[model samples]
Target: MKNNNNKLLNQETLCIHAGKAKGDHKGALTTPLYQTSTFVFDSAEQGAARFAGEEEGYIYTRLGNPTTRELELKVAALEKMEDAAATATGMAAVSGAVLSFVEAGDHVIVSHAIYGCSFALFSHQFKKFGIDVTFVDMANKEALTAALKPNTKLLFAETPINPNLVVLDLQMIGDFCQQHNILSVVDNTFLSPILQTPVDFGIDIIIHSATKFLNGHGDVVAGIIVSSKENIAVIKSTILKDIGGTISPHDAWLILRGLKTLSIRMERHCKSAQTVAEYLHQHPMVKEVFYPGLPSHQGHKYLNNQMRGAGGVIGFELNGDVNTGRKFINSMNLFSLAVSLGDAESLIQHPASMTHSPYTQEERLAAGISDGLIRVSIGLEHTDDIIADLAQAFAHIENVTGKA
Candidate 1:
């Protein structure tokens, strides 16, 4: 592969060739994995120079690895950021980014609706450390304004928020953070860089659960944080270096391989999801559908301006009660009842009971995640088969409940 730093490549090209090793590993086509725990030094003086930061080299796997570095560089280039850090898991990216900058006395602002674990980490875990967090609906400008404080150090949000499919205005948040001189972090896990790049909107940091669309396969669990070179250096030296939330070289390598096909996989996911969402929107059994691809969706307005695509996830409500919804989920033969999205296998899950269980019922309702709402992650399956599977589930549920 040719390495050209002077020429800016498109996202599709970047996915396959960005940050690739240049004529290294005995001229191997693929980036070689450096799976060793630590690197050997030539002499004591050289080792001391490396430890002192006078020389550039890897000391230990936790500090850095060649394979992992490639993954970080690739993701950073994709997100159009200065640097990136790969973590053991998505939560690691979340916690590390915030903890590295904020102290116990500082306050933080977060999106009212986010992934269940992310909600827990901000609302519960941060509270334990005396770090006050205000959960405001980022869509509400007044609410966001009211939540800000002099002690606020960072603002965290997710676009096309998990399970609900609500889209927050990235430009608004970015402008707010810039005016306030506070760091802004966005969890780009839902759309990946293929559909949306948060950095384009002036977001200070971008985070991802590499376990999802980035990997495209339901195998390795990993996460990455992309940000400015200065911010990433701070996070790597503090949260990652001392706390040890580094990713395994093997997992990083797998993610690198997965990135090679991300563009095509995401294209298929979006195409199938749009069809599925349209189907659900017209179905008698579905009382409501939440997908940006549908004009009825509030997020539809942001389609062209804020996002390149509507992404693969869809949220909907059944006409019947919660039991009917459960039966609908269980009756599906093709869509597995599982958590996590952006996989090759289609998945169906209930937010109130599954991913968002960490939140209290009142909190879930306040955040607009209803008990009857069903979240589906559209996969790379044939569109006809995917719709047929959902069609059968709807038929089964309506037949048993006698309501449609």
Candidate 2:
């Protein structure tokens, strides 16, 4: 099963066969989970060489593992990067990538609306370490340009941004970063490599919470950073190793299995999500729909230009208040009330009280997260059933408000 023509293989084929090699024992089709803490060297001289970086043999699981390496290779190939590094969690990938490059007194410009944890990482954690960060509306080119400073080392963005689904212009931002010599880091967790490839538009680093769509099953918690070999080497040797955020070999294996079905899964997710978003748009109780697939969405044009399909996640606002939002989420039957997205099962969550609670009310509003906002991660469920569940939830809200 040698991958002689991997470069020429289509994405679906690459997902199934890339980074996989026949086993030495029984020719196992799947990559084996080398669930061990350390690998033994043939001799002391070989061990010394491995430790000194003169040879390419795994010494310890913390530094590297066969399963994790295979997963990294698969993701790097999918993202079209030179190399990649896996981490314990998505936040680990985020923090590791940023910390690996910047030091005290450096500045970073980040999108105004990102995942709550990412916002906290920049605002609270990074600030304490003397790393200044400016949150700007990346869609506004002038604002983004104004946010740049002499010490700015990175420009961070999340397309079809979390909860709000605000898409950014990758080429525009990538060019700015290139001109300024600043690293452009994108959290491609929402779109994944199946829908959008950030590296194609000149993005320098790509990050993902393999816990989401990458794992699809919602069983494994992992993250990965993809970049050029030089950048990955620094992160692998320093940030990933010293910070102790290396992903477990077993977890890496689970993510590897998930990658095989990524293409088909994403296709289903996109199709179903479009149906759901369209249904919500015409609902009387719905205030607004924030899916990029919807022509009315502010990011729709950018999504059309940069991505292959609109993603599965959709955000909408109830025509009422926070209590109405809670009632709708609580009344959902088919859609599970959960925190995370990109699962095989439909999930609904209220970001103001859940994922984005870390942000103050004003900050949340600034990021387009309103109290009445509700986000749904459309899963592999049939489109009709998902829409019916949402319709019933809206009915529940209507009943509570005496409008039914």
Candidate 3:
């Protein structure tokens, strides 16, 4: 409800007040959606200027709208970027961000461990259009530099990568891309900009699946690309406009409402995840735990350096094989077994059978995801209650398999 210019408003304050216009509207606080396909201008000259991009104004929902602008500006502020562009879905943001600078013959360097859909889009879909890609360990600075080419247009990565939770060296990747004048695009959905900001590390662009953390509830589907106004103009004018992947104004409004509590929700999720991860690590039937928060995790220190705190997902391996993993997920009482992550209710799933099932066995192994591994999207529920549910499930697992 306030036109707060305080760009440095604490995240909590920004969540509630960042995009609001005060001194207007009968004291209603929330953003009202301008649910229209096209806006009418005052005069023919004004309409011409709006269409010509000579004067800044919303002409069509497909190009931009007030509700969508509120959400985009809020996210841009959250990620500490100059501007942002809202899109139809997470993949749309990914494709639009990279394809903005790349073309049929240009090259891209990507991490091996990443969202399956993103991998498919870059390595498979882009290849169909003659775009080239080199996949390597994004954490390995030497390998990342070596993977680059004279024609490489983008250095793409997802830190604490989807499902498996691999951490990439954002600073190194950012530096290398800068030296080559290439864009560094990061998928910040897992950690959200609240937990870790890739932009601060010099990443050229940041992408988020608002369907996940930003929504904080699984009701809306959306994505966003946050960068400077210059980059937004370049990307949206081409791939985003021609492809026609824009988020509806209503969905944008929902995302804005959800963002008001992002800081509150994330703190709970990460805190719950830490509790559960510790329990899993100490359990006898648990062979291994893969949460970045745990000190024993291989990437714990790297995570500490990059993120403000450990994230909300906890990944662990069971004593048995794929069937055991399925049984563990099915036997859980309190935690729902689902494919998607970053919801308000706790969810558990086996990557081998659910989210990453499309990957071959070798591919899963390469990503450090095993058939016995389970991932939990910790929610904003009572920690002790969550731990109790996991404890009961582990007890059953150990009774049947005689392992922790």
* Model 2 per-residue lDDT tens digits across residues 1-404: 35556677788987888777544736676788899999988999999999998998889999988889888888888887888999999999999899999999999999989999999999999978899999998989999989989999998999989989988999998899999999999999998898999988899999999999999998988999999999999998898888799999999999999999999999999999998889889988888999989999887887656998998899999787788888888899999999899999999999988999989999998888888888989999888899888888877777779864
| Model 3 agreement with the true structure over 1-404: per-residue lDDT tens digits | 35457475877887777766543556666678789999999999999998888998889899988889888888888888878899999989998998888888899888887777887787678868899999888777788778878888888888888777777778877788888898889999998888888987889999998889999888888899999999998987998899999999999999988998999888888888888889888887788888888888766887656897788988788778777777777778889888677888888887776777667788778767677878889988898889888888777777777774
lDDT of 1: 0.92
The clash tally of candidate 1 reads 0
Whole-model Cα lDDT of every candidate shown, in order: 0.92, 0.90, 0.83
Clashing pairs in 3: 284-404, 285-403, 285-404, 286-404
Q: Which stretches of candidate 2 lie over 4 Å from their true place?
A: 1-4, 22-25
Error of 3 at 339 (Å): 1.7
- Report the number of the highest-lDDT candidate: 1
**lDDT over C-alpha atoms for residue 296 of model 2:** 96
Model 1 / residue 107 / CA error / Å: 0.7
TM-score of each: 0.98, 0.98, 0.95
